[model samples]
Target: MPVTDVTTDPENLTMTIVADFAAPVERVWSAYSDPRQLERFWGPPGWPATFTAWDHTVGGRAYYSLTGPRGERSSGSWEFLSIDAPHSFEVLDSFVDDEGKPLEGFAPMRMKLSFTPTAEGTRMIGESHFDSVEALNQVVAMGVIEGTKMAMAQLDAVLQDLREFAQGKGTQVELLDDTHVRITRLVEGPRELVWRAYNEEELMRQWMLGPEGWEMTECVIATEPGQQHRTSWAPVGDTPGEPFGFEGEVLLVDAPRRAVTTERMQGTDGPETLNDLNLYEEDGATLITVLIEYPDKETRDMILATGMAEGMEASYTRLEHEVLAPAERS
Candidate 1:
């Protein structure tokens, strides 16, 4: 429900929030109380979180830290007021110091988190009460609601992904530019076969998913920053429509190291992503780097939410086994 009311007494302040997760109470509760599952969506945008302590008892405490841009951390804690397994709980929570001491000037809070089972999924109610009306007013101005939801959203998506993975569907990925993700493997094949996996038509066709309808009809590869790669992308198998073509320019490429950079052009569309593909050779193996860039925070978040990087890794894993491995064995 929309924040129905905003009121404060000299000694108290409260705010309420509601969200529906597309899962059962057991799933939702596990996501909430399980420390591993809790950290995924636990902070405001641009901040990552880690749960340090969680003891779900009447007097027990839960603690977590939100790490900011430069690795600085703001820690918060929750003292359990009540906990009813898989249903509802209440806690006295606050932002505190490393030693678990209350910040000298900040007021602590009593928050209620309730999970109600619904036909569609689980309905969550998170209500927070501050120590004073003045404190509540300050938090409202500071956007506690948004912050809570951000944290909750992360939890929701993380659980949904775990559910998917358990069912053999897929994993979820969150892309952060500053975080370097290196995926490497030794390919027994020669550089030429590796290069073909990247640039050759017939060889590409062997593994390019075109027969099943997922390959690009044409790629204009100029092999340099100023050059262009003219290409046309087709839909995957069973897709009902003609192919859509695109032109992409080679933004950078180092043939010796087997890397290529391209700027997507007309007929090409993607998730506002600036993507770079690099291949490094050592002892005849290619270390590939799929570098992706975003213009700003909004798009970074969009790309992150899509889990494209994770999907890329999965598909690449399949390619390495089915495509490259065979060529080497041949």
Candidate 2:
């Protein structure tokens, strides 16, 4: 697995993967075209299915879940484009974020998955286009490509091992996956005000934690890709207590507009974990997207299971009631 090319700009990121398989084009087609079959072989092995619904027609949707080895699970939907039987197909894919909202920035992938019959078997080629090169890059930076490929490799293995049920040898898929708590809420506020809530320490502290008992003790900010911005919280009972902290570099920042990139260093064992936050204004309101990309399945599931949505909702709720409220008055 040579590292896929990683290129970035202020607006987008792109990733490409080329691989071949020994299965016939038809078999390969089934693995990608049919939602039922597609779900079986997708994602890292040991990933279980929670629910999968497929409508294999253009304008139809395919929804499925894949639980990773460490119980980390993800669910996403696909909108079919042209379903060329046994040869090619196109679909859109996106997951329900921690907020349980389909962040437009992260969904609707236009993928051209084609299979060419070869003397040995089939040469599979897939190309997914974004609304623009920037979107492609944004997702690539979000770590979707690596995750998608990991899941696809598992799919490849599953298809190869498929046996004839008539021969008493059939591949059985075990659907056991982890689940996450996702919460969604819409905020109506100016982009600048909302940006202040995130970039300004005074405002960030207001909504970043509970009452003073759990106030943010440490706040640091640096405006660069490798910079760090963090805040800490301490419980009520501890005396001279150290606050729980979050440490992450400033991957990319377009202050007053959006900040996209990674986080996680305080409690992790390796490099910083991944996170991104975006801000877009529409019709006098600012729409923001915040993403937390875990380094591995273990962390992914743990972070999800830790009530990320609830925690975030609490903060956003505060932002609305505290910060945005004041902005509205003025």
TM-score on alpha carbons, each prediction: 0.52, 0.44
Q: Tens digits of per-residue lDDT for model 1 on 238-321?
A: 875566544555544445443434333364374334444534344555545454555576756654565445535554555667
lDDT score, residue 108, model 2? 59
Q: Which parts of model 1 have CA positions greater than 4 angstroms off?
A: 1-12, 161-330
Q: How does each model score on lDDT?
A: 0.60, 0.59
Model 1 TM-score (2 dp): 0.52
**What would the per-residue lDDT of candidate 2 be over residues 1-330, giving only the tens digit for each residue?**
212332333343323455566678887777776555554446433343434577889998766765543235566777887887888888776766443357555645666767888796777766765667766666766666656555565454335532221122111212123321112234667788888888877888788774334666688855666666766777767645455777766755657754644566577755445444545454455544453454566766666665555566667768878889878988
Query: Number of clashing pairs, model 2?
Result: 16
